[model samples]
Target: MKNTFEELKIAKSILKSLDDIGFKVPTPIQQKAIPKINSGGNLVGIAQTGTGKTAAYLLPLLTRLQKPEGNDPRVVILVPTRELAIQVGEDIAELTTYSELRHAAVFGGIGWTKHAELVEPGIDIIVATPGRLWDLYQEGVLRLKKVKHLVIDEADRMLDMGFMPQLKQLQEIIPARRQNLLFSATFSPAIEKLAEEFLDFYDKLEVAPSATTVSQVTQTAYKVPNYRTKLNLIRYLLEDEEKFTRVVIFVKTKEHAEGVFKVIQRKAEGEKRILHSNKAQNTRINAIQAFKSGDVRILITTDVSARGMDVSMVSHVINFDLPRDYDDYVHRIGRTARAGNKGDAITLIDPADEWHWKNILKLIRKDIELLPLPEEVEVLETEFGENQDQLREIDRQRKIDDPTFQGAFHQKKRKGSNKRSFDDKFSRSKERQKRKKRRKL
Candidate 1:
């Protein structure tokens, strides 16, 4: 008997391309998704990174594209980041190499005229970031009416970046009859609401256990005293006599990303690079490619690369700063242990971060043994109250001199009293009006 995708009855040419790409058997996600996709149902594929999800949706869409019915772009894929856009575009290109169907990538980092030129002949598929695509749509350079398929990849990230408004606007502009496919590494309840808003009567496809970390990765954590101590621990970890050829360290903020990059550059006698939203687009792309090519030993990046990164040989992933969200923790660890290779992930957790640490353990449903701090370094109970003393002093000064806080607090109380007083007066006025009416009667 034929497989699920084959049973979906894809076109011969598309099947030929799939076979050429060495895709005989579909992954669990593809297995579950292809059949439903062939049935023309809106699909929400919720699986972790590296689950062959790109092919799951691409193959089904390509099957329909090979039969060519209308002109303007037929498939539209929206991604959160430029790197993801490029990755999706490459995947589409690989699947359609033998076919005449064209694919165009639209993102902010490159010149729009180049993208405009590519879009001139129109395309079978357009993979883009929400902001750039929204700009083009508003400028009248792109048309969504001819779009037959709409795919929103990384719905949670897109929502986190505040693209819901743009997505709703795009939905209003695009034809209502298009097939919708929403894919993400994790499907939280918030993502579910987005799927409902975007897709009608969609079939949900989940490839792995929700909110679960990759089994192939070894997860470990260390408790540090403070941010500076965490940095020292990262330096110590990277300098281990047993070194990894390629390592990606995830930081929580843009400043921290640059700071880590500097520290690695100064301390390591090896190559390193920095990637964050603050960097130019080309710089970010080149950094990713360089790291993938093993040209860069260490890549310091913010959460931008924690999701949708496809590098297979990443040997180690270090979380210099533990992410507050458990889902983010899962995505951060996913960067490593990909393509059937074993990888290691280590995190530095400060006492202040225990709240997030607790949430993470709850999400993973496992006990994460906390590694002892380096003996040379000192460890102490993180002072939650001491850290806020500076802010408290500032508030005190404001109350003594500026009077802004005290005035605001008193003004709020006065406003509340006035509101209550107005309500009483209004009630008395209404009662007087009722009595006057009764007297007249």
Candidate 2:
């Protein structure tokens, strides 16, 4: 196996950029993928988010496109979200520093005219979300005829976000003879179907199994009673500012993200920001920048910021709520322990979340260490409504597992109750009618 980027025979200019960025060695995915991509064939890569998958494809594609060619973009990279588009654009800007390659990162949440202006000047590469890309193509501002390289990053996420139609349309628009590259963190049947549709006799590579967590990250879970207790625990953990330097807290919903942010904002040791789908594009970008630059110590967000975030120094990842999708747990924790840095992933599992957490364990095929709550952290009583919600969720899960299981929340019915009630009402009606008739006679 090749150990260094030099052994991989990357261009000197790109190597210099990598060196400047403090990357001396090629990750496993990078090592395996660069060669296959350089061979000029369609390829599919299965690897986790933090395993240097972006650069694996970018390095070779940039190397091949040594200089700018035509007005239309030669390379089109489609990502699932605006955040990922921005991140990929930044990477392209950084990697192409020594060379002359014009690129644009276009996504929704702003005017399409602005993106049109960016691409109108002539671009060699374009990183975009599917919706924005389709809009640009329809407006006659972007042309796909010159595209030689087509990349779909985070394919699983695209499916999750329902971008399959856009992807199919993109395939129809782009040139048929281009090199296709699809990289995803997990390989599912749906992904296989997508590959069948997108790639033409492509080579498939898997650096690691699907849904595998990063080995560098230490996994631990705390069995908390409810939301209030989780907040208290978070407060207690944040007290150690030195150990918990940079953290990303993942919540399941925007409401919960706001709640976590409010609590952390008041008592946590350092600055914090919240991110979700509802936040404005600029606000989300600024929050991500602050978190990346170490200006903010904590970022409380939904799964919106989970995939394609390339922060290397995150000290810990806190799962404030279990993700509804078991596969997302891997992506959430992957935000930490990036670029070969060791980090920790801590999950606060309430009673209702236990079943989901167990399912996550089964998916990842590993056991996370369970820890008792800290003595300083107070475990508040679970609220009545919250308790009932938990119970209801538990019942729902039980019913799913055992079709015949009658849960506590399930309503009970006595044997022959309906029949007996109907019979009693009929007898009373007949007796009243007979009494009326006798009186009339």
- Over 4 Å off, model 1: 1-24, 67-71, 241-243, 374-441
lDDT tens digits by residue: candidate 2, 26-122: 9999999999998999999999889999999999999898888889999999999989999999999999889898999999999999999999989
Candidate 2 has its poorest 10 consecutive residues by lDDT at 414-423
- Expressed as tens digits, the lDDT of each residue in 1-441 for candidate 1 is 245557767677777877886777767777788888878889998887766778888988898887544446889999998889988887877887777888888988776777778776767789999878887777777787888899999888888888888898888988999899999878888899999899978988887777778889898889776766777777777776256768989888998987787776777756798888778877888888888888888888888754556898888999898785668888788888876678889988765566668778988787887888887655544466644643454455457656556632233444455455778889999999999999999
**How many angstroms is residue 3 displaced in model 2 relative to the true structure, after the best TM-score fit?**
2.4
Cα-based TM-score, every candidate: 0.82, 0.96
Clashes of each: 0, 0
lDDT of 1 at 132: 81
Q: Write down the TM-score for model 2.
A: 0.96
What candidate 2 gets wrong by more than 4 Å, as runs, is 414-416, 420-427, 433-441
